[model samples]
Target: MPITGTTRVFLIAGDPVAQVRAPEIYNHLFERHGIDAVLVPVKVPPARLADFVRNAFGAENVGGMWVTIPHKAAMMALMDRCDPVAQLAGAVNAVRRADDGAIEGALFDGIGFVKGLDHFGIPLEGRRVLVIGAGGGGQAVAAALALRGVGELAIYNRSTDRAADLCARLAAASGGVTKVAASPDPAGYDLIVNCTSQGLKQDDPLPFDPKRVDAGAAVEDIIMTREPTPLLKACAELGISAHAGFEMLVQQIPEYLRFFGMPELARTLQDDTSEVRALLYPK
Candidate 1:
């Protein structure tokens, strides 16, 4: 897959794009699969997101865009239509223009998070879960969890109102089947997921006390840094099973491929993502 005039270009936009790992992961997949596609990262400030998106989509060769960080929530308004999950989560991480020039949007963070849990054999059905964050990522993860038949879902955010709002939305979407509420308490939960940026900094304190997590409970931090976050370290010390965000990210590759109209490639990758996982997190 040499870069050529016919290459399908995909842009991933964020204010600080240097930290993004999508280009490396997706480019490797495209090249290895003999697909004429390229994913590029672009630094677009929040104020210029709309303009940047409009101008980028004007180019005929542009296939789609990947939204990150501050852009996910804002990207929702830019879509002609959004997937139900995106609407429920109030965010969109992937966007593409249809043959009719309609902009379609979707959020894969939550879906990927749940799938990653499955990949690690962490059961979710009928399990009590606590999500510590209510931002875009948190909302997406919580929304997905509620729909996954979790026995109970609790959200904890610095802003109680935000967490409460997300819980309400999730409860309504689940037809009252999911017992969701806003609470920072992690005790008694079967699984705890950290969806906050607290773990991004080395010195940042653990999102929640691992000692408070129940015995045999598992924890997952959605922070994708190579170094283990403090939360992971604390869980390890407590003899609790903990995981990094690598699997969650690795799991999203196929979803993005399918959203971008590469269904065949998506299916192929879904059947076996070990190669991608190894590339991202080598043992």
Candidate 2:
């Protein structure tokens, strides 16, 4: 089929857009499926976010955008209405312009993390999970895990108030059944999630002492790098089941594509996971 003006356009906006690998991942998938859609990263400073997004919707070719970093929380006010998840998470990572010209926002971080675990056949139901960090990613993880019927959730952050606030929000959304606690003990949980940016730099310390992590717990870090993060490395050294951030990234791409009204593109991209891996993790 010949492509026409119907070509779909997607944008990912963030302060440090240059470090994002979304363009490489989505572009590879688009080519593989012969879709005319293209995904690009846009460097939008904090001050320009509102204007940039408002103007973006004016372009008929623009399907949607992927929000990131410092913009996630700030972008919520710009949307017409937020999805329940985004509302609860207090952030928006994906946005779609509705037929009525209304912009709808959603936060996919939690769903993506949960899906990644599902992809590995890891069950969170009835599992004791500990999440470190109470920021955007942390809140998302808590919400996602609660939805999976986690037995208990322990959230620990530098600021106890923020942790408590997120716990209260998630508990309300989970029908108050999701037990939220505050603890830094790693031995008490079945799963550990690191949502902080600590691992992005080489000098950052592990979120928690390796000695405290339960040997039976499954560890997950939302940081992608050639070498395992200190936390992941410690988990590996202790013989614990662990995963890197790349898995979560791959798991979320399909959901993002679907949000843009291109399920066919999502499926096509999902079908070419091997090629994506090659591009993202070239030998």
Candidate 3:
């Protein structure tokens, strides 16, 4: 299909839109599935986010926006309503205008992270997990991990207050099923996740000391990049299993389709994501 007036437009907004893999993934899906849609990246700084979103949505042909980086948490305030996860995480990765003209948002990062863990054959129930960073992605991953009935969930961030607040919200929502706390020590945790943007650039320190991570524990860096991040390199040197964020984004594809009003496409993807995975982690 050619880019024409009928092509529904989706914009991904971020300060640095160059690192995003959504357009490559979603556009491939649309083209392969014969859907007349296009996803493009748009760089919108923090100050102009509200204006950009409002004017972009005003266009009738604009389908939705994929929130990224600094925009996720801030986008929540612009939404008329958000799903429960978004409310809990105070962030959203996908947003769209409803038929009633109300702006709606949803967070898929947590579910996608958990599903990605399943894909990696990592156990969640009754296991100790440490999530570094209390930003939008961190909050979403922690919230989803709590729902998985983890034995203990520890949040580590530069700001103790932010991590403490996230723990409080999870406690209320999970009814204390999962023990949540604020800690920076990575020792003894079965699973450790790096949800910060630290690994995105050179000279950025690893979120946690890989040497301190317990034996048999797995580490995951949620920064999407084609190359191995410093954290992953450190993990490999220590002989520990470490994975990138590609799988997490891959798992979110179906959820994104469903959120964008393509239930059938979502179902088809849920049934078999092998092709998508292969595309992300090709030989």
Candidate 4:
């Protein structure tokens, strides 16, 4: 896909943008569909994130922006409208500027995540779950699990305050679902999710010991590394059903395209994803 004077542009912003898979998949969608657009990656530090949203994101060529990591939480304040999902998740991973100049923020992490869990036969309804990280991805997944009518929800974070706050928020919106902020204990959980970037680096420590997770439980990590992450590999060693991080990201592509004004594009990716997955997670 070549750049042109009239090319419409979108961006995926994060502090460490090099590992992002969004630009690849999104650009492929744009090229194959003949859309005069490009989804580019930009390393926007925390200090400059606000300025980018206020000025750069409002440019004529800028059609949308995808938020990641540290920026996902900070983006809410910059959006003109925050969707219900984002409001509940306390974060937004996708944002699109409406024709009226309103930037509507939305969350797709949980939608994609839970969809993968369902496809893999790991049902969320009435099941107890534990989430690690309590960051943008963690919050979104936790809120999604709560809305799915999970039996219980527990959150763990390095920062106890963050974990406690997220637990409170999820509890308030979780209805009857029991929510707790506790250390990573996989004793009674049906599913344990690692929403942090720990698996991105080989030296990174496991978010929690896979052996601590009950033999009957399932595990998932939301980090796509060069290979299976240590945590997922450990889960595999323990004979647990471990899900790939790509599942969450790929499933969310449709939601993102719709938010970007290409609603019909969702159908193109509705069923077939083998090719896209290969392109994204290249072995």
Best by TM-score: 1
Each candidate's clash count: 0, 0, 0, 0
Error of 3 at 243 (Å): 1.8
User: If both were scored by TM-score, which would come out higher, candidate 2 or candidate 3?
Assistant: 2
| Candidate 1 structure quality by residue, lDDT tens digits, 1-283 | 8999999999999889998888998999899998999999999999999888877889988999999978999889888899888999999999999899988899999999999999999998888888988887798998888778887788888888888788788887665644444455678889999999998999998788788888888899999888999989888888999999888787898999999989988998999988787778768
TM-score of 3: 0.86
lDDT of 2 by residue, 126-183 (tens): 7888888888888887877767778787788888888888888888666565444456
Could you give candidate 3's per-residue lDDT for residues 208-240 as a string of tens digits? 789999989999899987889999999999999
Show the colliding residue pairs in model 1: none
The model with the greater TM-score, 1 or 2, is 1
Error of 3 at 105 (Å): 0.2
The 10 consecutive residues of candidate 4 with the worst lDDT sum are 172-181
TM-score of each: 0.92, 0.91, 0.86, 0.88
**What does candidate 1 score on TM?**
0.92
RMSD of 4: 2.4
Clash count for candidate 1 is: 0
